[model samples]
Target: MDSNRLVAGITVLARGSQTLGTAPIPNPADRQHPGDGLEGLPQAVPGAVGLCLSGGGSRALSCAMGQLRALRWLGKLDELFVISSVSGGSWANSLFTYLPEHISDDDFLGQPVLDPSQLSLLIGPHRLDHLPPHNLGEVPTRLGLWRDLDAILTLKERHGYANDELWQGLIGEQVFKPYGLWQPDASGHDPRYFTWTRRYLQGQNGILAHNPGLKPGSFLCVERARPFAIFNTALFSNDGPDADLIPFECNFQLGVRHNFPAQPSQQGAIGGGLLDAFAMGGRYLGEANGGGWVSSGRPARPFALNDIAGCSSAAFAQMLEEQYPVLSGLVPRYPYWPVAERAEQDTLHYRFADGGSLENLGLNALLARGLRRLIVCVNTDQAISRDPASGDIVLSDDLPPLFGLQPFQPGLGYLPYSAQQPGQGAARLYRHNQVFARQAFAQLQAGLFAARQAGGAILFRQRLPVLANDWFDVPAQDSVELLWVYNDFVSSWWKALPFDVRAALELESGGNFPRYNTFTQLELSATLVNALAHLSCWCLASDSTLGNQGGLSNAQMLTSMFD
Candidate 1:
């Protein structure tokens, strides 16, 4: 048979199959191919076609072989394509295990795995806000915007399908439209039920359309390789003008409603009181938002061990002298002020009034860990220092400095690219930093193990340094140098410390970090968890720390150390 003629015929059959109602054909034994007259039907259909049968489950592979058989009988056996909805589970199991190992290039039933991009086109566009019922006519209309299977096949013929690019594109698209209707529950709050129902029907349809005289085993191959497509049509709206355009990306208004019994006002209050009584006994402080005593009370004190002033060099030295009287003489010997002077010249600020210091912020702690990993980052300042001699203020570089300094690990530094260049390295570091920050935040919310172990404490502080004069020279006097040292102490400490340290200290001493005046206990807890997870990973990987001498893959390390 001419290959083009065969392909055209197969397309017609496939299109017709799609038009069939959701149910599978009632009688598998009664189906007949168009070109196959009674004698032709038996001969044209491959014997192996009968092997591909849908059993109880609704899966694409169960009926793939049957479709192939039908296509072959129509003389369209050039190429058989299979696309996966997900990378794992039954879908992957069937495809990798059951499909024929090899098929002739010219065969009409050759199986090929489809890239996600191709699958996206096949599934069509999905809008969640206004979901249409699953009627046959509507299915095609919903899928109309997508590149048709025919067009995709043509692209495949020309460019050859590559899974990576297709999958990446699909992932990127989802990043933009997280709640697209194609996702489970795109329409219904519990959409998986509907998805499963649809899959079941499709699988049955394949079995009914199966050819007779094929081995039952062949059905398994079909079931594993047949491509199943789904369309997503979910939509979400935000009232805020500055709300993120990315769907489902923000947590501002997303929620799942629950079904529960309700009682009349007085009765309900009493019932609630009873529940609250039990909760108090069990230490289940009701919902965080509930009008319980814990929820209604003012936020708990911030967690901290040292006075905020202790973060400064002068305070640190004074505290050290007070705690270890013998060290009082040594405090004047070390030039902590030079470091502080550098910091002051660098426009870093020093705080002394309320007890806030850089050493306790959670963001700084995570950054410190990242620095240990040899990852470069830039710190931005909103203001610039004026040059005294030039009588003009100099704007810093547009891009932040690309530098990484390991605080705990003495000297591990890298400058793969110049800070002035702002090239690929800068871009890469920028993206890496952003992703790391976001992941850190997410890890905190998820309450990773390290976080839980730390007793839930975290802190963050912003420093805005404005240089008053261009020629701010390092002072010779020790007191002036001490001021600079204090500034340096805050900046360096802020970058490398983890929030859990403060939380742990707070638990031990019942004290709060002076700087974090408004932070609540819950907020601190969340931050601590995130910081601890990051720090745990850093410690595990550090040669100086645990001393575990195995080089595990990044994913494995993250899972074992943080998960």
Candidate 2:
């Protein structure tokens, strides 16, 4: 588990040979394609910065949009080496990464794309190509209700469908449809089937090729600086030995198809580690063939962004069958050939559920890569307390510890540490919880419940403890600085909003403006979405003091933390 051994696309056997269960003979020419693994992206460094986006359906999506825009405005977006997202946060990640080359910040966050008071401009008849209307005229801005129903029917007919697929389809049509990309289809008009293909990245005249600025190159290359994406999901098995190995009988896994480092046989083996992100799905075979492990899979439809999104957000897919039975396709499953011993036997199918089911914050992926500087944006309604008189969801003075509180909450702070002071089991940094002192936290808490709250976003900075186990190999840094970003409606920006605009938002949310309502609220009104987004943006970008405890804004603190 040495840190140096975690290089991308490398195998324990030799230069090229990779195996699932047993060591295979070395072979140099085993790559599936020229740039099969991590070639399209830069390698992650020990101290690189990573951003984690949490899971909260549409709430996370809107908050992430605002946060990302604010990050871009603060000139920190280009500095991010990795962005790990789960559930709704994955929606924003996919959209942000696939943006057309010409769309600038102004074009992205301006009037046409987002209008705070009006309905969502991204939906309905409005095309995302509005800034200068791109040549992708065939792509519709949004697939209307009936179109989606028809698409679902088609999908159900082809193969049994599920709730996750329906959710992913709607997300694609709404957010990513603007990019105008699709998997090659025979009918050529099936809007539900868009794809994230290698053709879009490395083709002679690919999307990235057409715009050299966004091309994959050196991480230091400012022209191509984009955060490597890691979307997380829980690999589930109700009855298997693997179930015992993982907590809740589910493993916290990532859908990072490229650049994932392979482990030695001492560690749990990953046959062939991970294939190309675009090479997933379809039929495949792995046989001895009297040679090293050789894999054979037909060029069937590969897993797209939507597929990953569906899997990552399938958190409630299993439990909500009684509510939406028609949409409950079998628990999201993926086929694997390496697990099968014989070629005649069927491929082993593994079930996948929501990443949040195992780790809601999406921090595992960044930590797995050994990144030491992290920003975790938690846009969840799960931690709220209700008011007795009103019975409405309200911000509680006692905020449950989201990260870094051991015995009380039992997370990162509770993990056994490898590095510690001579006589101490853990460093003071590892044991510490709140970023603010007791008095300061009390003051901040009071302000949160006051008639006029401070701001909608809250920030907590903690040093994440390095686990003693082999799962992480963060040798360069002793501890990680995790900036916790919470979604709360206590911002000065919220107080300053026009009365009419504020009222409309409150009405949409039934008076508890930023309750972020139910996690199942996948669809939201334009007003509520914009209000939350505006509040989120202001929390990061506004120059005003936050929490009534710190004179600096969240953006300023973020810059100084990285510096």
Candidate 3:
């Protein structure tokens, strides 16, 4: 290993946490690279905390907020070193970090993430008037017989938005720009892309000097080593073995990531890019499509947060499949994505799918980064499909059973409730999503079992490990440990809405009207209380110490919900 080079690199980083892109890959000869090597940083220490959130549209976002609130209430927000999110969870993460400068920190921090008033404001008279003829953003129109349906769809489109405008609407204009969110008009023309994530991690100190009165990033409800956003895109057919997981991790610039899982038998190399070999803990700091700040050839340019947002949105490909056949469908405005890498033409011709398509929850890539406590928050019931008769919602997009997650930790499946067959749901769309996830998981397990039975266990590079590695799992209970806090839910957020309100959401608009699926803050908190109660067993204080203590004791929460 290039110990001298590695030490020198780390020393430079110690002096300047912002010199991430400047660090060179350590020892390409030995293939020793950096993962949690951002050592010296509080969160970079191995066996710290990892908070992972799943994608389930707005419902999941609200639930994540509830959990964040509880963590903040416990004064344990900064105990975390890393936090990862995908899809709807990503949406909430954005709101937490990228709120407009016009909104005071008190206004943002005091209120919960999903303000009921925010929903009201969106539905107010001004919302419809804002929709341009070319840009139809939720202007509810009525069809004769389909008036109710139109209302629901308009409501759905109103809430279920995935566009560049989302960055503006969610955080207000100018938050993601480098000129600063406060400087909305400082520059003559606004630069759409931002890579300033590294600056925020410095607290109230150095590179990111802020007002003495303003709180640093550390004081936020959720804090971490670095916040990572995951994005998934399909590779060419010949790229690698066809698999669900094509793992990639990024902040402003890319971090340690891979297009395939690490193969245990092959100790020499790791996986990244299109079937390329990177180090076990490699980090690509360059504009390359994958690999770190090393090597030659044309590098892929770094894309802005909006591109990452598009990649994280499951709604993108799902809507495409439903609206038009996959063979000919075009993701609106995606081709003209301002920050996308230039291709054959002035447009990007490739399609990007949901991260959930790889793993229903993100953090598949994050596991290798010395994670100790992995708190997985899931929103099982997204507004996937409608129930024609009762106007109920169906959330059946189950994730594949996790690979090699806590291998020694006995459970029916790696994740919660993954081993069992799902119960029935009446008349719904996307019910098949769960079926596909389960089927894929079963096939993967069967392959592993067969390999184990034959000779040596063949760990597929495209799947999660069947055994934990030094790179990912931490030592717990005399082995590499991962404290798993599992909660897969259809958030109470939707159910909390009035029954009539829900009915209205599902109502079908006859003529070109849209249907809406929405949720509230009440459901997230209700679900969070129970989940937080479940956290008591993690060496936290007893139920009595809980601000919102429940009837159950920590002992009662010992059993895995998956069991």
Candidate 4:
């Protein structure tokens, strides 16, 4: 830091402030002022205040408004000063409409805006000649320090007084030099490395500032004595007789949105030129979610799940083979063979100890463990299959036992002696099964409530035959109407419950949808995984009420329903 330059600037500013309100007016003939009545009369004791807006630009406007209101309440309106960029069109327009004009252009201003006050406005040019150029050749250099100093000097000449006590006191002192840039440790790398380093530095500074036992910047002194000594002088200064406001608090808000060009690129890249643009300048870079490349002004290459499909399948098989050898033996030779067969055969049954049965069990276990809280309601009954040769559909007792399930039977619908009651037979048995499924479903609903109490995310799946209820039928074999109906019902239930009572619910249908199975299971899984990666715990239900409850919470549920 150049002490002489800063002190000279401060001296001028202090003198200007004192001269503006209290000093005797100088005749227009005595100085360069016009012979108008306004000459030498400080214009209404022009007040000034400094404002710093930082972080997400437009997003942080509300916070800025609050800060402004607080300052007004504190009776600091007389000294209000606002510093913003020329690109801050929105904020500049807003402030100009509300604030009074005090002073104009200053040299340190990054972006200069024209104000109605006609006061001096400081505009800092983007120059980069003073600093040594190393790896920044590819980057466009903006205004350098020399231009910034010039702007500050210009502002002082316009408003500062040469003979004020504040001016003399500030200029007669020494100033400390602060580092222009921070360096990372050799061990640190890009991506999260920069974020961690910034956080560490902020924490260290905070600790020093807050520790009552030690003086300010004590820890900083231990690391860099020269800069610390300069800071100490500024902090403990008594020469000026009054504290001078710090002028260079660089804080501003920035908002950015991905803008893709209309013309599509001829390249075979997944996205377009937009991806390349984001890669170079997007706010979120070098982190886990920072792989989108900008090309032709668009996200040209986004991360895709197919990139890892082969590795994922191989890893999954290896994991299953290692963790559950017995079940692994039953797995088909080809990857995803079980799911493919499940879609093809329309035979929902598996022999008790066969690989097919094991697959189902494994799937159920995965759902139960991977999901926090789950509820399943199943309706099992015999289905008739036609013999083409005989042209007759024969009912068979071939329903498969549900995996991860215990034996259960539906009880009698009514008293056996009732006049409407028929003799105990097959018809009666079927009715009992239907009734049991509904009752079990009701019980599962209660269990969902219990799970939520235990701090678990809730999920529900309903599987019932079409004949069992009018609520669970599809118009076409491949139609998702039934699943949607169930989802809607569950959604309504979730909405009615308190936010803490119901977190999420899922509706699963066991029946096969021929048309919807056009895509291979592997392809579908890949797509599903890609979509699920973006899911967050925050859920927004109807009317945009944000909470942890309602809606489909699982990534699989979204993919299964929308895909």
Off by over 4 Å in 1: 1-194, 197-550, 554-563
| Candidate with the greatest lDDT versus the true structure | 2
| Candidate 4, run of 10 with poorest lDDT | 225-234
Error of 4 at 553 (Å): 11
Better of 2 and 3 by TM-score: 2
Q: Write the per-residue lDDT of candidate 2 for residues 128-226, one digit (tens) a residue.
A: 213223311112223333554556556556544444455445444444556543332452222232223343245453323323333243110111224
Give lDDT per model, in order.
Answer: 0.19, 0.46, 0.32, 0.19
Evaluate model 3: give its TM-score: 0.46
The candidate 2 region of ten consecutive residues with least summed lDDT is 244-253
- Give residue 221's error in model 2 in angstroms: 17
lDDT of 1: 0.19
lDDT of 3 by residue, 204-319 (tens): 33122322222233221112222333333221112123222223344443322321222433211222221111111222222322222221221121134444544565353344
User: How many residue pairs clash (N, CA or C atoms closer than 3 angstroms) in each of the candidate models, in the order given?
Assistant: 46, 10, 21, 53
Candidate 3's C-alpha runs over 4 A off are 1-44, 100-106, 109-192, 196-245, 259-302, 324-350, 382-400, 403-563
TM-score (all chains, Cα) for each model: 0.15, 0.65, 0.46, 0.15
lDDT for each residue of candidate 4 in 1-563, tens digit (9 for 90 to 100): 21111000000111112221112222212323221122111221112212322211111122223232322333332232222211111122123221112321121111211111221112222221111211111111211223323422442354342211111111111000111111212321011101011122233222212223323321111111000000000000011222211111001100011111111220111111011111211121111211221011111121111111111112222233355443243111111101111122221111011111111111121111111111111111222233455443222111121211122223422222222652233222222112122233334334333333333223333333221111101011111111110111123223443332222111111122101111112111211111111111111111221212344433233223222
Cα misplacement distance, residue 545 of candidate 4 (Å): 9.6
Can you tell me which runs of candidate 4 are displaced by over 4 Å?
A: 1-441, 445-521, 524-528, 536-563
Ranked candidates (TM-score, high to low): 2, 3, 4, 1
lDDT for 89 (candidate 2): 80
